[model samples]
Target: MARCETCGNDYDRTFEVHMEGKTHTFDSFECAIYELAPRCAHCSVPIVGHGVQKDDVLFCCNHCATAVGVHELRDRA
Candidate 1:
């Protein structure tokens, strides 16, 4: 059994994920996404795709970036 770091719940069949040279365990996909997913800095929602990053904050989309007054980065080559 593994314990979830976020919810402090123990699970019989938990999934493990490695990120940033660290290991994280979760009981469900939702938990894993909640714990590991990149979140929007302004809305605080989980960012599924390539999120916009301005300065040190992350945004889910251009609307969110515009709403927060952060200049969104352009596409790469």
Candidate 2:
């Protein structure tokens, strides 16, 4: 059994996620997301999908990017 890195739970069915040259063990997907997902620059929410990015900044959506004076982003095509 491996211990979850996020919740510190020792479980039997834990899984490992490799990202950016690091390995993380989690008991559930929720824990993995909480620990590994990138946060939006404007709202500070974890971006779980194909989020918007401009240079070194990240945003959950185009609206948030635009709200922060990033005018060229769009929500969709």
Clashes of each: 0, 0
lDDT of 2 by residue, 1-77 (tens): 99999999999999999999988899999999889999999999999999999999999999999999998877788
Looking at model 1, report the run of 10 residues with the lowest lDDT sum: 68-77
Measured against the true structure, the TM-scores of the candidates, in listed sequence, are 0.75, 0.92
Residues 1-77, candidate 1: write the lDDT tens digits.
88988787898988889999999988888888888899998899998789788878888887788787765465333
Which runs of model 2 end up more than 4 angstroms from their true locations?
none
The true-versus-predicted C-alpha distance at residue 27 of model 2, in Å, is 0.5
Q: Once model 2 is optimally superposed onto the true structure by TM-score, how far is the C-alpha of residue 19 displaced, in angstroms?
A: 1.5
Error of 1 at 39 (Å): 1.7
Q: For candidate 1, give the lDDT.
A: 0.82
- Model 1 regions more than 4 Å off: 71-77
* Whole-model alpha-carbon lDDT for candidate 2: 0.94
Best by TM-score: 2
